[model samples]
Target: MAEEWRRETGGRRTSAARERFERIYHTLRDRICLLDYPPDTRLSEEALAEEFGISRTPLRRVLGLLEAQGLLKSVQGVGTIVTDVDLDELAQVYQLRMELAELLGKLSPVMPDEETLALFRAHHKRSLGLIDKPDPRTFARLNMDFLQALLLITGNEPLRDISERLYFQTTRIWLKLTAHMDIAEEVAVFSREIGDILAAVEIGDLEAAGYIRRSHISMSFTRLKKLTI
Candidate 1:
């Protein structure tokens, strides 16, 4: 009985620690995406561990996860730095993202429960209100939230995970891109495309949602085509 109790205790502790690690990873990841931790920003393991009050073991695990996601790079003696966005790499990423997201559309029920439906509707209204704001960051973040809300209703872990990973890669890019954009033009474009997708979702029509998403993505790629990057 004592041996079994010890095993259970250890298991619970491990689970709790894993949850904490994930939370930290997400915190750092979101900051990076929001450009709160901008490109090439160096962070030492010791400093981060101390800041978070976590020991090296758990903190290292969080860093490792970020590195694997291409968000951070660990240098031999210099510690880790947030990776810069590569437009070429981003284009390749989107190719894969498009394919994976289509898989999600096929697998996802998109029939969100009433509570989720209500939540999504609220988020949609919120985005519309924010559309007039001049800050591209606001629009970018809201776009992320709206997409996340849609993915939440998908209930497919692999799809959700890949979608988030790819999305993060482009968040900082969006930040940069927004600076060069006519906010009014971009916001209008996003509003129309996103509004169409959300409307389809609101009615439980994943087919139309997927088509709208595809077209929206194609439009975005075309917009980027003129860039010398």
Candidate 2:
């Protein structure tokens, strides 16, 4: 009984550690996406460990994962630096995202529960509020939330993983250029996309929903390219 108790205790500890790791990863990722840690910003491992009240070892693991995700890069002399965004270089990545967006519904798609659908409607409502008063950071957060909710409809693990990674890899691109772009127009476009997605999901047409996502991605990329040029 004591051995069993220890095993259970160890399992709980492991789960807790994993949760903390994921939380740290997401926090760092969001900061990067929001451009809080802009390009070439070197992360201080000691400072981060101190801020999180953890040692560097576990923190390194989190940073390592972010590095693997293309958000950060290790330099010879400097620490991990946030990578810069380039639309031209990432053009292929955007194309891949557009292609994969169509698969969100094609591969083992799961019908979202009512709660998930309601949450999407909530996202749609919130997005409308931003159309007139566009806050790029808030809009970005809302877009991220919408993506997470939309991913629930995909039951394929690999599809979900790759889709999410690709999403994050490119999310910072728009945020990086918001100062040069018309954010209000972008917000309006985003609101419409959310509305269209919700409508498609409401009628149990996830395939249409996927196509809508693909269309928006393609259009957004086109807009970005034009802005950059």
Candidate 3:
């Protein structure tokens, strides 16, 4: 009876451990995205565990998961540190995002259903509502959500995977650049532009949709460059 009870307790502990790992992993990822854990900052597992009130085992598991996701790196003697922003990588990601976003616009006209349009409208509204909130972090997340919803219309698995990865990296950089820049007007303008793009797609004007999408991304890049200094 004691042996059986011990096995049951072990199983419960394993399940709880997995939950704790996921919780820590997502919290760390959010912090990284928001630039709370700035570039090249050393991350102490023990301190994190203590702060989160979790054990080392779960924290270690979370660290390994983050490392695999390219958000953290562990050196032989330097411990785990948040990875620095790579300009080259950021450029590549921005280029890829532009391409994929244009492709998504091209495909939007052929979605052949109202559900896709409805999703786009919903996200666009939410993004527009966030324009006056004065929080860069919230604005960034809503912007990303709007873009992801637009891309989901394509239903291309590989494209979705690539876009998500690129989106996260671009969002990280964007959040950093906008930390001190108040561009609420620009965000509101872009929100209106997105609505126009969706309207064009609904009318089956693929070429117009593509042009507007590309223009929006290009303008955003130009604006971001001006603020990075």
Candidate 4:
């Protein structure tokens, strides 16, 4: 009985640790994606550990995960630095994302519940507001939220994981380049995408929704390429 109790306690501890790790990892990754920690921004390990109330060991693990995701890199003398995205890398990743977006429907697609559809409707409404008051940061966050809600409709774990990683990997590019691009136009296009995706999902057409996302991704990449050139 004592041995069983110890095993259960260990399992709980492991779960808690995992939860903590994920929380920290996501927070840091979001900051990177949002450009709060822009390209080449050096992250202080000690400061982050103090901020999260965690030790260096676990914090290092979180940093390691971000590094693996192409969001951060460790320098020999410098600490973990947020990596920059160039047009070439963006092109490659965007191509992969376009391909995977369609797979969201074909591979184990899960029809979203009404509540999920409602959330998408909320995204559409929020996107409409951006057409007039186009705020890049707010739009970036909305994009993240919409992506999360969309991923929930797919049961393929690998697809979801790669889709999200590639998303954050390329998301910062848009925000970073907003100065040179047409904010209103981009927002308008994105708003249309949300509406179309929401409409597709509303009628129980997961495959159509995936195709819609793919089309937008391709168009978005073309726009981005023009700007980069």
Candidate 5:
């Protein structure tokens, strides 16, 4: 009985530890995305471990995950640093996002179930409601939520994985570029475009949805270019 109890306790402890690690990863990723950490900032493992109330082991694991996501680079003797924000890389991220979105549009002919459709619509509504909010962090999170919801309709595992990664990378670039601008109008326009795309999907008009998706991404690239210039 004691042996069995020990095994059960160990399983519970492991699960709790995994949850904590995930929490740390998300918190740190959000900080990086919002530029709270900023590009090229030296990330001291000890300092981060202390800040998150975690030890080096789990902190290293979290850092490894971020590194794999292209958010951090670990130098041999210099410790880890936030990856440089290059305009070229940002453009590449936008291109990947556009391609994934187009693929998702083509796959929309499969028609997601009613529950998934409802979730997408709900997220769209939430994004619309956040338009007037001055908080860029809130706006960024809601925008991600909306994109994630739309990506779910594709039901392609590999595409979903790529989209999620591209989403974070693109968001990091976006927050940096739009940090000083009042983007309320831009957010409103995005929300409306999402609604139009959803409407097209509902009617099983995959072609129209694809066109809108491409146009939306192209316009975003154009706007971002203007902002950076």
Candidate 6:
């Protein structure tokens, strides 16, 4: 589809390359989010292009997208480096997230469709099973999936777009702290919070659902603060 779009647009020099660039872009973005490529890590355009079997031209395009997302920066004398989170900004962003989450909860369908509920239940069971599984990455992925699925119940494009941006922007923060996070404790908290919120939604108690969601977000920030300076 990307190739077809590019071809139809008839862009010279770059039409045939959009698909490859997009794939590479998402791969690097996920690595950045998961800390597979840690902050302050230097990204060499030449090395990356070679690694991905692409050329510098398309590689720069991918890097540009990551930079625009605030995940990468080009430095003089050094190479492109992963951008570090500003502490104050992190606090403010997460604070805003609390309210945004509340609003989303209030706005989401009071009774989500059967598919949505089933997905939530699957995530719930998976989250419970991971509590003592000794794999932080797996659990974190499941938690992310659960939250994302729940957020989809809102069916608000603008809201989902903004919320998702904030989500990925801060996701690295949580992923970075997995080393210090208590897996069992984190799992238990997430399970209870998700359970309560879903229960409220099932009963059409949007107000209670919203409150529970806000409180859940607040608790996350509180825990993150404790680990931060």
Models 1 onward score TM values of: 0.87, 0.92, 0.70, 0.93, 0.78, 0.79
lDDT of 1 by residue, 102-141 (tens): 6555775557678877766776676667666646778777
lDDT of 4 by residue, 1-229 (tens): 1122233244455657777877887799889999999899999999999999999998987787778778899999887899998666887899999999999988998988888988999999999988999999998999999999999888887788889888988999989998999888988999999999998898989999999999999999888888888
Expressed as tens digits, the lDDT of each residue in 84-103 for candidate 3 is: 66776766667777787777
Better of 1 and 4 by TM-score: 4
Which 10-residue span in candidate 5 carries the lowest summed lDDT?
Answer: 1-10
TM-score of 1: 0.87
Which consecutive 10 residues in model 6 have the weakest lDDT in total? 1-10
Residue pairs in candidate 1 whose N, alpha carbon or C atoms collide under 3 angstroms: none
Q: Which residue pairs come into collision in candidate 2?
A: none
Q: Please report, as a residue range, the 10-residue window in candidate 3 with the lowest summed lDDT.
A: 1-10
**Model 3 TM:** 0.70
Q: Is 1 or 6 the stronger prediction by TM-score?
A: 1
lDDT of 5: 0.75
Per-residue lDDT, model 1, residue 131, is: 69
Q: Which ten residues in a row have the lowest lDDT in candidate 1?
A: 1-10
RMSD of model 6 against the true structure: 4.6
Q: Which stretches in model 6 have alpha-carbon errors above 4 Å?
A: 1-23, 50-54, 106-111, 203-210
lDDT of 4 at 25: 79
Query: Model 2 over residues 1-229: C-alpha lDDT tens digits?
Result: 1222233234455667767777788899999998999999999999999999999997987787788778899999887999987556689999999999999999998998899999999999999999878998999999999999989888887788788888899999888788899999999999999999999999999999999999999999899888788
